[model samples]
Target: MNLFTDIRALVIDSLTALQSEGALPEGLDFANVTVEPPRDAAHGDMATNAAMVLAKPAKMKPRDIAEALAAKLLQDLRIEVAEVAGPGFLNMRLAPDLWRGVVGAALEKGRDFGRSSMGQGRKVNVEFVSANPTGPLHVGHTRGAVFGDALAALLDFAGHDVTREYYINDGGAQVDVLARSVFERYREACGLTPDIAEGLYPGNYLVPVGQALKDKVGDSLLDKGEQFWLEEVREFATEKMMDMIRADLASLGVEMDVFFSEKSLYGSGRIEAALEELDAKGLIYEGVLPPPKGKPDEDWEPREQTLFKSTDHGDDVDRPVKKSDGGWTYFAPDIAYHYDKVQRGFDELIDVFGADHGGYVKRMKAAVSALSDGKVPLDIKLCQLVRLFRDGQPFKMSKRAGNFVTLREVVDLVGPDVTRFVMLTRKNDAPLDFDFAKVLEQSKDNPVFYVQYASARIHSVLRKARDAGIAVDDATLKAADLSLLAHEAEMAVVKKLAEWPRLVEIAARTNEPHRVAFYLYELAGEFHALWNRGNDLPELRFLQEGDSSATQAKIALIRSVSIVISAGLGILGVTPAEEMR
Candidate 1:
């Protein structure tokens, strides 16, 4: 039902006909031949570079090839006009019936209209928001969570078996800090003045974790040394922190299919198995890494260590697997995690990380490449920082998170839908400004509001039509005589609607869910444009007084617009509004 795909297939069929007629070479490659909307709409409805791309290979003039192609394409009823533009670019205008048919297709498909098989059921593992289980998630993690979740949804819409995953950083020094922080809370719960030291977590959220610890053991570790309580407290505190994180994610409508833990990798021989896989390929070695480029860590020492031969797979240098003290480096488990994903038989992998972790991108890709022997592709999307603003001034602080703005705080102020949409209004690698005032504003400047308002406006039209006794449902709309929708403005909306399935595949293939946001905004813009025109032109309106046939056609068109809008928002994890509150 994708109009663009249907048209492109027509173009390919015509080209094959041209080949059969001896106008083109017997074995001309049409891979580069593309049919898309012309940059300047004034030129035509759709443009193709078929003639231009084949001219050089076929040893023919561009205009000569375009002229023959245009003549052949015009034979199809779907194409009304096919003409050659500058340098033999063939611009073709489709018939009004074709655009009208797209509306019928949308009404028939509903929210599933744009769903595609671009991914071909390939298994994909997307690991994102793998924050340390030391504390609750903060604003920094929110962007990653939203981006990753949206990406998984987009791929799912594009037909991938996507697994939403979170890799817990529990094996790091951050969890050790969590152990000490909880010990203070445990003492405070026991009626003892707790030492809230400088290096500890002082958030009120952990106060309950401390209380829970007292209830579990009745202050058995009261006035005890770190040796006796550290291990017991660390495990208890990590569980509580993870619970808080899960609740925070639920508040934002994000749920992970897998929560792979780094600590689990420690004692379970998973890390050993991953390294062994690498070792079997001779990618593991005992070597000393050269002094790192740029300013080195103060603790950087020249010592022989176990290293992964990542340089063989495009890394700048080999990276340490185990530090000099025999403890695994942070990179070790990450490699193992990717190895596990590859072994799980995913055809593709994507990692979402903060901008500060840019250096890890190359090494992680190298590790996945070595692990998969380049059989699978890995893409890492680094989300830039989000700067929150209130009243044009930078907003900061989190009473619960101690210093950073927690994700729960952002979701509390603005519901999960607003938070998620605003986070995606910008590219993943670009800085985003989350203005509290602007986002909630009902004006068109707010993209979330703009998109939701369009959906709401559709319901408004439906209600108006229903009160007048005009039966309104997708099944009726699809069966309506859509050819009655012959207005130029109505056709423009149909053209925009035709872009959805193509847009979904593009966004999924690029692993950029932000593209979906941008596309939805643009689609909503066109819808609003047509809705506004109805005020000046009564015949252009969805409801035509005393003309049931025309009204049905118009309703089918606008109803299709609503259908595509809902599907686009669904991929973005935003609720399509029926009416703005």
Candidate 2:
């Protein structure tokens, strides 16, 4: 149960009773009232803005409303201390038994302890890791993969119907470049000195693709011109690259529910259908855009282009849907793709793009808004670059990719768990540094290690308790007398555990999965603090020397910590360490 939500409901019920009794106005809006953790823990367990938000509407002084509300709240046994803090803010201290019950609830719920129904089963399409089908995914795409996967998992835990998808960039000119590059490798496979052109992709990862092409066609297409092999080779090479990409994502434990192809939008009537819908809405027009923001207008000449009235929604300027040559611009396919998602009946759409695509955000949002007639909302999250370091210096580029570190290279070096946890340690839009030495270190400085170590500690305690002939199974511990867990240090950990469900809703609502990582780190810290306190205070020790009852209470508390940690790590796509070597 969410204590914060429970208390908020209590406050709402009290306010409604006040209105029924004619103590307050009958039609006042209470939507703005909120119950949240007190900014300062010492102030109280929870705080509410009911009085401050309702004062003017009720035509009553803030203090008077707060005093009346405090009286109503104090009647509940859960709230031990209800007092007015600043102006009209009400802070309530919950009874210790209420905090102890959180541990029982966590142990009973296990990994489902923090699961929330915040999304209410709304359908959400999370499209991420849409890296071009050009070569192996790089470290930049790795961040998006982990972030998007974790976000999908987070939303699912928060009760959203999430679909993880990947969009292939096979329809673009880059795939043509890839075809030419693969053809060079194919020439080398045929015992010819292949020319490694400067503009072509020079990564050696395509050497296998070249050899595979030879195995398939047996030199049938060799010595052929662009017209004869370009289309076939482009299709063949894109499939190979996508196979390699799927393998890369699998190595990191990511799977896509859909792999949309940009080529599918072309040659089909989908692009026309999307644009026609916009045209019917009077959003499509023919116009020449002003010179690009920072470019010189002297070299810019006006040309009539098919434009979308993106500015009418929220964009800085209208965007071109088709170029002056009447060919579809890059933005056209993207608009059609989103329109397809809307037609598929997604309540919400989220695209995880690299930071370099930040300029496309506003126009994309505007297009989706116009297409959905404001019925659906689209959120675009940009993942910034990742800098790699090893041995206190910049890590060398991949020998395979030849320019950037591949996702497989990072995963092979430190394993996928470390790669993912470290990547999410920073916000999606913030640049992250992956220090090879620091991340694998055993110290608390490594958040991944620290959090996993907390789970390891719990397992160790359970083993020690079992060895002492004490029952430590979840069912037994859950039925333990939690009232015996009254130490201040023990209560601190339980309080943090109580915030798990609340934290889940907040993180999911903000569309930020990094908050889960941050919260897990903080929870681990509190747990470790309690464990260390046991070293000095014999009474705080989880395993009492002779008292089985006291030991059971402490075990219940720590076991609950492990349950929440596992739940948090599960959302992050990380497996909790049962034992750390």
Candidate 3:
């Protein structure tokens, strides 16, 4: 049902025929041939570079190859006109019936119209929003959460066995700070003057964690030092923070398939096992790293340490796995985590990180490359910062989150649907401005509203048709006289629908789910364009008075639009509007 793919196949078959007839040379490579929409619609419906790409290899002029290819293509019933343009580009207009067939296909497939099998059932692990469990998730993590969740959904639609994962940063120094922060609150709950240290977390959200701890164990932990209560309180407080994070994610409609604890890598021989694999391959060594580039001599130190030969795998320099104190460095556990993922037999791995982690990407990729022996590919996507604005002014911080706005606060302001859709309105690597006033405005400038309004209008049309006793169910729409949809405006929508399956594969291949949101907005624009035209041209209306055949044909076209929008929004984890209020 991919019209472009089918047409490209036809072009390839015709080229083979030309070779068979001796009109072209044998053994020409057609891999470079491509069929896509013409850059300028005035040129033709679709354009191909088949002749241009094969001219040099075939030892023939491009125009000659194009002329021969055009004649071969016109023989097919699906091709209406195949014309050669500048140099050797072949522009084609498909038969109108072919466009009509796309509408029928959409009606038949419903939400599954654009689903692709391009991933071929590969096992993919997408790890995102691995924020520290010291506090609630902030606006920065919100973007990563939305991006990662949408990417996982997109991969699933593209036929990948995707596992949504969250790597808990519990085995770090940050968790210890969280435990001490809660201990201050615990003392406060016990009617004691607490010392709120400058280094500890200062969020009011920890007030409840402190009260909860006091309720659980009474005052037994009040007078104890870090030695007696640090471990017990660290474990307890980490769980509470994680619980709050889970609830926050649920409020935004994000759910992870796995919540991996980084602490498990310690005391379980996992870190040593991962390093042992590297050691067996001669990737581990005892060496001193050169003074880092761009560093002042006063700030640089030279010391022999246990290092991983990350340069052999593509890192800028060798990385230290153990510190001078003989304890594992921060990079050690990360290597172990990815090694465990590779050992789990995943075919591919993807990590979604913040923009500040740009420097960390090369080292992480090097670790996975060394651990998996280049068998598994790792793709890291970094999401840039989100600047919040309210009424053209900077928004204030959330007191509950200490100094930043929590994800829950954003969700509360505009609900989950708007929040999710607006977060993806920009590319992951680009900075995004989330304006409260503008996003909630009911206008075309708002992509979420524009897309949702299109869905709502389609539903309104269906209801009106049903009330008028015209059968508008998908089964009936599939049986309509689609040939009546011969108008150019109607065909424009069909052409866009034909690109769905292709667009899905492209977005999934590039690991960019924002493209889906962009496509939905374009589809809605095309739909709304046609809807507005109906007011001026009576024949273009979806509900034709006293003409059941024409009304059914028009309704079938719009019903197809709704099907695609629902599927696209579903991939974005946003609920489509049945009716926009």
Could you report the Cα RMSD, in angstroms, for every candidate shown?
1.4, 1.0, 1.1
TM-score, candidate 1, is: 0.97
Q: What is the lDDT of residue 382 in candidate 1?
A: 97
Stretches of candidate 3 off by over 4 Å are none
lDDT of each: 0.90, 0.93, 0.95
- Which residue pairs overlap in candidate 2's backbone? none
lDDT of 2 by residue, 293-325 (tens): 785778788899999999989999999999998
Ranking by lDDT: 3, 2, 1
Per-residue lDDT tens digits for candidate 3, residues 262-343, read 9999999999999999999999999999986784689677899999999999999999999888999999999999999999
Deviation (Å) of 450 in candidate 3: 0.5
Model 2's alpha-carbon lDDT is 0.93
Tens-place lDDT digits, model 1, residues 53-82: 999999999999999999999999999999
